[model samples]
Target: MEWKGRRQSDNIEDQRGAGPSMGGSNPFGRGSGGGFRIPMGGARRAGGGMSIGTIIFLVVIYFVLKMMGIDLLQVMGEGGQTSQPGFEQTETASRRSSAQEEETKAFMATVLAETEDTWSGIFKAAGETYEEPKMVLFSGSVKSACGFASAASGPFYCPGDHKLYLDMSFFDELANKFDAAGDFAQAYVVAHEVGHHVQNLTGILPRFNQQRQRMSEVEANQMSVRVELQADCYAGIWGKYTEQKGLLESGDLEEALNAATQIGDDTLQKRMQGYVVPESFNHGTSEQRRRWFKRGFDSGRLDACNTFQGDI
Candidate 1:
């Protein structure tokens, strides 16, 4: 990719060394794996509401426990469980030098700027305004509106805050561990999360979250696959626009496709557990991901990227 000297986005929030502490509480739940998340419903009080005195007493007790070195919220967050499994965690290699980190940050900013331009144009053409999302750059773990997440969760877009949370270390794992290396491959990861933001803006994510409330776990997982594939398709659309501007070089498309293949739920499952369970698949298979991305790249039309209608 010819990204040098290109315009960079100003919406980046660099919190590489200032990630959230482990004791923090995540009331909503852990964020989803890499992609769009279904907003988890908060626990509701049963048997009507508590009295004012009871509420005040509970608040006082909460602070008392905190002063005594106990966090009820943290305990609750830890106890909360979900059937959905997040992305696998891998040991990141030693951190890159300062120079390399800066370059990667610049590259990410430039890629973000490209997506902003592409999506802005597309939205304007459809008589809608595109609101650009902020990208948060953190190191180990970060607290988001969705919840607290580590780099193992990979790069994800949180609809609650309309922001993309990323840890650059994941890119290292993507290359060294997953064998998907290249600047364009890294760009694909960013584009995929940004695609989730686009879904949120289009009401797709909100509708999905609302519907998933009543859906069975298996049914929700199946629907999640479609949502993730659509994001991949959206990423491909950005790639198409980038290519038209003569930014994509030889093998860039393959780099992105390989990255998509490497991170597919099926491929990761097979590699991690030496088997695959189709029922637990939230993201699509390797072939499905690659195909959907190519479908968007070839057509470059919003309607062509619809994975929910008919066959994906």
Candidate 2:
């Protein structure tokens, strides 16, 4: 993939060294300590305690901040300082990142920009507006609206916050452990997560989440396979757009296909535990993944990527 000097996304939140405890304020207009609180009660109680209305107001504020991706209680526990420490640590970590890691970050940003452009165009053509999702880069562990996650959890999209969380170190694992080397493979990973964001925007993810509440464990796993495979197909749609733009070079398509194959549920299960359990397979088999991706790549149609219509 030739991504150098291309447009990069400004929606990336580099929280690389901020760790799980450092939940920063909202990146989009929710200012830090803006002092716009409702004074429900101006006077304190007889014993120097807060009034009932004051306590209720504080509780409301807490929940509001939580919804905005800011853990106000956590911030108060950390001395009411959210951005300074995390910002300084992230800056130091960025300076410490090797040249290669910085390049990887740039590549991720470029790919994210590509997805934004591609999806925005598709949405606009359909008479809809695409709200681009943010990507959060972290090291070790991070706290998201979905809860706390470690780097070992791999890349994931959180519908609760409409953001994608990624650990750049996973690319090294993808190459060294999974043998899925190459930048296109890395782009596939990023695109796959963005695909989940697409699902969230389209109401597919919300519907699935609601329906899964009444499903059995086995049934939920089966449904999850469809969700994941649809994401793979969506990634292929992005790949098709990229190819049409002449961004893909020789062997790039193969790299993405190999990546889809390598990370398939069957392949990963066999490689990790020497066996495969079909019922527990939530990401489909290697053949299924490769086929769906090819379907999207060949057709380049949204309708071609629907995995929930039949036997997917």
Candidate 3:
């Protein structure tokens, strides 16, 4: 957990306060206008004059969504609008980072760098070049190639864009709401998402998607469980590598294990809904998650994370 003064990844996109309406233009650019212009690609522009009734209706809908805590800017491109060419097209909002938020960002960058180093070596040993994925930092909501997502969806890896999206507030929620705390726990989350990128690079994700089309709901959910469990195991593989480098302090492993358990499908379902549905459990149970992570940590081999091969 001692990441200070360590190498940091340069692939981080700091979209903390840039909202979607700003279009492909840099949302972080200095501007006194809160509203930014978004270029529409072969789509209807927003300049048409509206009747009073239409404006009133839209205004009411806006207020209703605001009451529900929905971000209006994030919905701009969700209607299938494509960005103009030459624009990065990340729909994000700009906001000032708090002292703690800045520290968390630094930690995330350092952990990403460590994962890059460890995985690069692992991939090189396997006679392959690792293509490191970008990690995006956002607040509230963000738009990606995969679609718009809110922080409530938690941290996710979008294979379509080959990037990991994170809302740093999730770390606070992890500690306070899920009872999983510590720097290592946050690192575990990043590693797990990065593990998804690894799966994407190895063709496991595409194969899973192809096969999932032929699967029943329960079977597809089971396949998803395998995918998620393998990511957890991959996170543990990174944990093992960091431990070898003397980067992990005492109790760091426990924090990650606790995090895995706390976010298990069964534990979360029971806590939120008072019951657990096995057929709907896409990420495995707490025991399964903890066991797979430990298995990878103990063996430190990619082959040890073959969760799809047999019963997990």
Q: lDDT values of the candidates?
A: 0.91, 0.92, 0.91
Question: Which ranges in model 3 have alpha carbons more than 4 Å from their true place?
Answer: 20-97
Best by lDDT: 2
Shift in Å, residue 22, candidate 3 = 8.2
The C-alpha stretches of model 1 lying farther than 4 A from their native spots are 19-96
Instruction: Please give, for residues 1-312, the per-residue lDDT of candidate 2 as tens digits.
Output: 989999999999999877445355575565556643456765667857687888899999889989999997687767645557987999888787777788999999999999999999999999999999999999998999999999999999999999999999999999999999999999999999999999999999999999999999999999999999999999999999999999999999899999999999999999999999999999899999988888888888899998998898
| RMSD (Å) per prediction | 18.3, 16.6, 14.8
Candidate closer to the true structure by lDDT (higher is better), 1 or 2: 2
Clashing residue pairs in candidate 1 (N, C-alpha, C atoms within 3 angstroms):
none
Where model 2 places Cα greater than 4 Å from the true spot, the runs are 20-97
lDDT of 3 by residue, 1-312 (tens): 878999999989999988647566766666745545665554333766566788799999999998999868677765334543213333221223366788899999999999999999999999999999999999999999999999999999999999999999999899999999999999999999999999999999999989999999999999999999999999999999999999899999999999999999999999999999999999999999999988888999999999978689
TM-score, cand. 3 vs. native:
0.76
